[model samples]
Target: MTRFPSQTPHGEISEVFSDVFFVTGSVDMMPGFRISRSMTILRDGDILTLISPVRLSEAGLKGLDVLGRVENIVKLGSYHLGAHNGLDNPFYVDRYGAKLWALAGMEHKGGLSTDHILKAGGDMPTRDLSLFVYESSKMPEAMFVLNREDGVVIAADSLQNWSEVDEFFSEAAANAMTKGGFIRPANIGPEWKRHCAPAPAEFEKVSKLPFRHLLPSHGTPLLNTAKTDLVQTFSHQFS
Candidate 1:
């Protein structure tokens, strides 16, 4: 049997909105360097979907069970599997027989593979959600727009709102990230911009989405004001 990454220190999953939950966790970047990351969970009746999943503790698994069965695992970022300790998708798939979803061009590193290919206009895990793809990015990067409570945007690397350094970040990692200009509120992911170089028009289309909340893979949830709060970021990056 292939051994997958073990569960690391992560906070308990907590409800951020109606049926949306998030868990803050740490990613091992290198030997002793670690940084914060997050996973978004969505519930529709008894079916649960995990987006940009983080390996959880035994207790966390039990908590997840109480909510519903893990039926779907969604990957919204092309580079998500590259995080050293963030490779937990197969664990869920093997354990619960869950289906994995990702964009067509996303790299399946470390023997990771997807069960479904998500597109800009195609089937989604749920009916109330719609997909948006970054057509200009070198790698496949996408976002989910949930059509509920006005609107909610779920993203991986395209958007972020770190707010502040949290427990998941080691001291050295935190300092380095701050210097790298990643510890900001309502900002485009610095590294994603440098690597992906998505077209400005792509974000312009995102800005027009009806989303009011943002559940990012690497930052705190920006509720209600997700769209308004990112006004300057969109302008600065695009303009």
Candidate 2:
């Protein structure tokens, strides 16, 4: 299994404002293997609620800057808050960001410092957006829930990425991810399990969605039975 390097290319892809219009970009892997990163922009006129911004270049930053007023930004997970430290933007971190806020200190990228701390009601105002907070830890990993009527779930590191994580990692890294509480073999670890656990209950919450598609932060967006495959894979590991 060949490992693919990170290829988000740093830019704005698409956005969804409150008016029911959606815009996004495609993230890809090497050659035929590619994927797209997502940044949700929920807007009410000049007010923009940005999801996670990618590693954009100078020009890409210009494009992202041109997109909207971008008042408040939200980071959905620990890893999702990647290397854009110098970005002097206001950020709101739900439970996930609060858990990983210390990381912003290590590298000078991502949600450096901003107004508004993350709290429970974060999802209520963003009702048009989908919200999935899987209990990955006491800190919890943030999973983006698409507020679309379709009900798709946009997962960051929780679902990681197939192409981003090679089959080799799935085999060898399983032990490490298992111990680190990110993933497990066949079944999942109690630490990062969904809806904070018991598996079945997590399955129930996921099943309630009318959507079958998955938009992951890395690799590719999955459709068809990929959703079921991922669920079953995680379920099998539940102990």
Candidate 3:
């Protein structure tokens, strides 16, 4: 089986913060839609933690080598585990309770397993990084917070920022996503709510967190005023 749908000649790695970088790749989800998968790299000293990993090409691997040695692989939820095939990483981690519920389904679907289960307030491989369980969504999802001078929240699938469809998107898919409320900037994922049945109170609690940058797996990163944007975007759902 193909590890990835397609590989870019060079992984498009962009620095989000001092020691944080992101790579974007394509995923074959909808026929006409150009769905994207993002991999977030958090570098601590000479060690790196890969979150929601995507398969990279030879040049991409070279790009990653410039960063640091990859020490750990993390899947924020079950839905983000598709591209983790054949990775010989040292450590792997998943959501705390996902093994109890998602492991069977993942095994049946030929997905990989985690070496460690992560929980909120638990220790991560990297220092100054913390995990939080998004209790609002029924699906087992975890969000990471980088406690730096400027706080950053690394989100999985719940919060998206698909401002506009890119060149990879088919016209039909773009239209469908826009109409389905999936292509908005800094908004809750429509399909996630439909499938996971999230509660607004959970997001209300999230809105109160002091995060300035929002790095989502699906869309562009909100560099500034991310908390305010999140509150304004989904506050109505809370009420």
Candidate 4:
């Protein structure tokens, strides 16, 4: 039952029913776009997978109080970990961003618990969890899938959410998915296509999952046909 702001180390929770939920926090990254992101609240029996950490401001955290004692906090990638509040679970990451996550901690506080590598095969969410980590065509991108009954799949930088982007980007540059926010193949999302390079094999592995929808950290989530769009997005990414 802890709370964070949309731009600070705060969180907000909203259940979309059927155990599928959404939690968002506000943030103040830098120049433009005062962002507000939500983490998909997923629960598989006892294991809770918080999708993405939303930026939370001090006042924002005070407003949207969230309650969820997550058994684990699974970070999608290194840059994505900025949303991490203070959960003491085993930190996990795909290949590309683990070192950065670790360095960020070392340079700032001290360090984090050893991070688990999200490799193929072991990357699948399995047993109703349906977790899938694609070594994206962009960076060391990692995504999640929780199955039909579970009703949620947390997409990291793979989905370019224009709806949300419009709010962040000025009216002139809204569709700048390739510029800033999530998975921007063109030049969006602020993430360069380097460092932890994308692994096509990884994306293929995740492409064959049965997810009902996708909930991304940046932009708007692919609510209904998230699985399809997710697969297509990656397909075109490598194609």
lDDT of each: 0.85, 0.44, 0.66, 0.46
Regions of model 4 farther than 4 Å from truth = 1-12, 31-33, 44-49, 55-68, 81-110, 115-127, 135-141, 164-195
Candidates in descending TM-score order:
1, 3, 4, 2
Model 1 bad stretches (over 4 Å): 81-86
**TM of each candidate vs. truth:** 0.95, 0.53, 0.82, 0.60
Best by lDDT: 1
Worst 10 residues of 2 by lDDT: 95-104
Q: What is residue 215's positional error in candidate 2, in angstroms?
A: 2.2
Q: Which stretches of candidate 2 lie over 4 Å from their true place?
A: 1-8, 11-47, 79-114, 117-127, 164-204, 224-226
lDDT of 3 at 207: 77
* 1-239: candidate 1 lDDT, tens digit per residue: 24867677999899988788999987788867788889999999989999988878889999999999999999898765255423787788878988889989665535767788998778898669999888898778889999998899999988999989998888898999999999999999888888888888887898899989999998899998999888778887667
Predict model 4's lDDT versus the native: 0.46
Candidate 3: give the clashing pairs: none
Model 2 TM-score on a 0 to 1 scale: 0.53
TM for candidate 3 is 0.82
Sort the candidates on lDDT, descending order: 1, 3, 4, 2
lDDT by residue (1-239, candidate 2, tens digit) is 01322324433354332332222333432344333444445555555555554434456545555655544555555534233322222222321132222211123244255344344336333455545655433334555556454555655445643433333232444444445554322223233344334435665565565666565544345555545766776556553
Scored against the true structure, residue 210 in model 4 reaches a CA lDDT of: 65
Model 4 quality (TM-score): 0.60
* lDDT of each residue in 1-239, candidate 3, tens digit only: 25324543224899988888987765555455456557788898877778766667767777787898776766666444234322322113221122221211222222445556677766576778777676655667767888885788887777777787765556777777789887888888777777777777778778767678888877778888788888888866555
The sequence of per-residue lDDT tens digits that candidate 4 reaches over residues 65-122 is 3333343445565545343432222222221122212211211112445344455446
